[model samples]
Target: MASAETDSKSLFSLESYHVSEEHGFILPEPLEELPPYYKPWMDIALRVPELVHSHELRSHVNKMPLLSSTFLQKHRELRLAHLALSMMTMGYIWQEGEKNTAEILPQNLAVPYWEVSQRLGLPPIITHADAVLANWKKKDPDGPFNMQNLELLVRLPGGESVRGFFLVTLLVELAGVPAVRSIPTVINGVRCSDTEAVARGLEIISKSIEDMTDALRLMQVYVDPSVFYGIMRIYLSGWKDNPCMPKGLIYEGVQTEPMEYSGGSAAQSSLLHCFDELLGVKHEPKSASFLIRMRDYMPPLHKKLIQDISLQPSLRNFVQQQDCKDLNKAFDLCVTKLLALRSYHINVVSRFITVPAARARQLREQNHDSDGEIISRAPTALEERGTGGSGIMSFLKTVRDQTKDTLLPEASKEVKHHS
Candidate 1:
């Protein structure tokens, strides 16, 4: 039995959370007119410890073995909590009521319900972004990022109640992905429960993932694999909760077999499965978001390798034209390496070389020491041959002859055997 003073102290403890100088938006007060169903959303969030960290929720759902309706129903207790977390986020930046411009109607300046109340008039709708920019201008016309204005805006009594600016930025960043754009819309009179909104958002995002199979697979090469894994986990969790749901089924239609896992930490073990099958990895409760994780795990060299492979005709056009067998094999190896690198390309390369370490040492024992670095200088023979006065035919013949020794080693051998 806690005393009334203790309750007051606990509630007040969160007041010191800072509203950064960058946060210009403010959440409207909680809606007094909120539907009864919305009560669970708000209360469950306050009651559930797991719901507080949205990232953790994503992580936990992903690591599960089989996400099915029964599992989700068991975790149904988390639904409202999930919604509460999302609603708090939405309150900060959801483009609502606003039309072409991003302005909150002055009369409709909805404060959080817990804050001071005034029956403000319903303002005209505008594009939320435009309204936000316009409002920022009105708030601080001359200031750029409006450091001071932003600082003041954040300090506004009721608006400063949620998490820091970083979380908002992270949400905004993810919202740009095509999958998020598919978030379902459920407009019911200017006020919807946060839980409902998040569910809709999640639904759309999950559907989008299902729709963009190829693109998502391509993204595996660019984004963090771990984050991809997390996103997949969320999708799986949703799917497990609703087995009939068509979410994350995009890859199922692709004529490819799913990859199997090798081993690693519970968080990263899925790397093995993802690399084995780029777009065909089966969903594991643990590493469903392996693609996201790969994106996060990618090193700078991985990007460089992808760029080089994409640019080099051998790898780039190979997929399109289906040419040279050796080049095709090399290109496949490159893709595997790109995915397997996860966080450290150097380590992947080192591990790759180990199988032939003795051969490599023997080769090194004879050749010039070229420390794991690729050489790209122009060939001296080409420069000398160009300088010599030779007819185009003769020059070309010379080139053909030289190429035979290097690039055309197999062809040269065939020619010798024929001779």
Candidate 2:
């Protein structure tokens, strides 16, 4: 119901941002491979898992031809090229695991990857954009978009768990579709003072967020915690803020100095960023800093959408102005659902990262005959922090707690404000 004038003022719609009505932020009909000329990249890309498994990925990459980016003409072609290059880059860097990271990306892989990344406005490293958005294809084109039918186009060190991790994350994005579709209704309803429309929109968003939390449980069913903690996780990690590659990566042909970029993260997903702005969820300085930096990793248009949403009139203020109980309840429910989603995310992180890390620590303790002999400094990069380099447990808890703060107090719920 948002008018053209309102939409123009806001600078976005789902259509403008490539946010799909059905798939939310998931890229539609993603190309599985680039044109025939880019097969050298594809050849290594499709073999990422096998090469990593055999410990020959670096040797193979060293032998790769420095292919040109000129053949990538279409939008999807560039997407696929970026995907191939990103996976190859991640594999090449971490093929020997985190302790033995390759600091310099070979020119054979770096040049065209850099070129394609420049064209796409993405960093020349694996991001959530590469690992999740551009990495899926359907087992059956006409089939349902569920685990059985969905597949990853490119993979890293993790086996089936890699597919599970990325695809389940993809499904979470899919689950967010209805919430995204209802944003305009919330904004427009607030604009027109249509309490009922605003309430309806808020309810849809609440239910959709709940559905997103439910979709997150799929990680338990599909991803092996040990696999996620040990194998696939390293591939997603970047040199920035990481002790492993302290100087960051040198894209051999592109720059003389090392460039830093964070690893792929859930923060890179625009769903929560958009929701945070629309609903006004305030994060603490530490969490807010990481969250804001993540916006830089997102596609420019997607990042702009969140910025535009923040610049608009506040939905929370609009709800605060209304004394209608339905509007009050709707706003409350939306924030409550967001709070629940954040809590659920913490649980998932604990299951996937926290628990595995603790067990690994205990194993390390056991492996050492004496506790004094247990070396604690190494493996701490991933063991204590997330791939994005935030202190994992504290960061998740902070975000979850901040989400709880957005809920309106019971006394304020039905009060008619004069201001």
Candidate 3:
């Protein structure tokens, strides 16, 4: 455990962790392509969604040549490699939707994916890091940063919704830059008893949380609920905890025993973890166990940044000891904003997962067709689980309620009264 004095004395810099002052956790200039020798990955990765739709993805992936990870030297190159391999892995595993799942990842894909994942401190399966943070490229370098100008370098099974799901998430990370930039200010202010600076930083974070929620709203405009639940989702599912692959997947060349990993999840995003640590929000055991496990999925540096922020002198403690109403109020408002953001996340889950799940149930009950269209559509195994493997509604609601628990005594009373 790091002592508070040690944490305060050491300078915590975002750049040290590859977190940008202007882009937060979004990779600054992700390479869109790899070297010529890596053509197999890019060719198959770029065509995943199309190939899957045509039912040729598994065949193409099974035929892929074994490639070595030695040539990927640069950081961005490694990221692009991971993204490409991760996409190929997903398309390969879930090519025939969720029913006819592949149990063994062929040595051609498995060997390189395991190698790159080891080097990057990410799981061999697709993660939020691969799908969102390091997956974007602008249409024009000089153009303004907006949805219209942004696009994914690689795609998954869901066409427009896949593009929308990833790009919208990238924009939200982009919108969080100012808040990330202010983290040091908040910590330094707490260290020196500078209430005004702390308050100012908290306010910026509050507004950024609001902006993130606003950006999340675009999901409605970009991702169709039925499409997300029925089509794009299964491609994101991992072997672990999924009934489709009860024993987990075998990485052929890496290990004889099967390995398990969660699929792409918002929990893998470091932004919320950083905020939760900084705001002193303590989660109950259920949410905490799952969130803690998610850190293993993040880039090591990002996981370190969240851990270091947690060890810093508690901002909540500082505010409570202060004589400044502005400081206390600022802390309260920040927590309140985070609560709203989580609430909005639940709303998103409702539209994309919950509601669609209910409709799938209705359709299944009504259509006694022998073909089982409903089971084939979204995989009955995944309707209750979140993108990762946590219990969908309960996990989110527990997390949201935990955020509410972080409010100061008086603020808790007020928020509870209103809520």
Best by TM-score: 3
Candidate 2, residue 239: how far the Cα is off, in Å: 0.7
- Per residue, candidate 1 scores C-alpha lDDT tens digits across 95-130 of 121111111211112222111111111111111111
**Candidate 3 CA-lDDT value:** 0.89
- Candidate 1 global CA lDDT score: 0.25
Native-to-model Cα distance after best TM-score fit, residue 222 in candidate 1, in Å:
23
Model 2 score (lDDT): 0.83
TM-score of 1: 0.19
TM-score-better candidate, 2 vs 3 = 3
lDDT of 2 by residue, 1-419 (tens): 34446545643356777677777778888998677877778888999999988999999999988888998898778888888889988888988776788989999998998998889888888778878887899999999999999999988876888889999999998889899899887877877777888899899999999999999989999998877886678788888889888999898989899999898899899999888999889999989999999988877788887898888788888888887888888898898888778889988998888887787787676775533322232255688888888888899888877776677777234332411
Residues 1-419 of candidate 3 have per-residue lDDT tens digits of 12346454465567688887778888887999899999988999999988988999888888889988999999999999999999999999989877788999999999999999999988998988889999988889999889999989999977798899999988888777888889988988877777888899999999998899899999999987877888888988887788889899999989999998889899998999999999999999889999999999999999999999999999999899986888888999999999999999999998888887887887788875625442338888898998689898999999999999999999899988987
> Each prediction's Cα RMSD?
27.4, 4.2, 2.9
Candidates sorted on TM-score, descending: 3, 2, 1
Which TM-score value belongs to model 2?
Answer: 0.93
Candidate 2 Cα errors over 4 Å, as ranges? 1-12, 368-378, 411-419
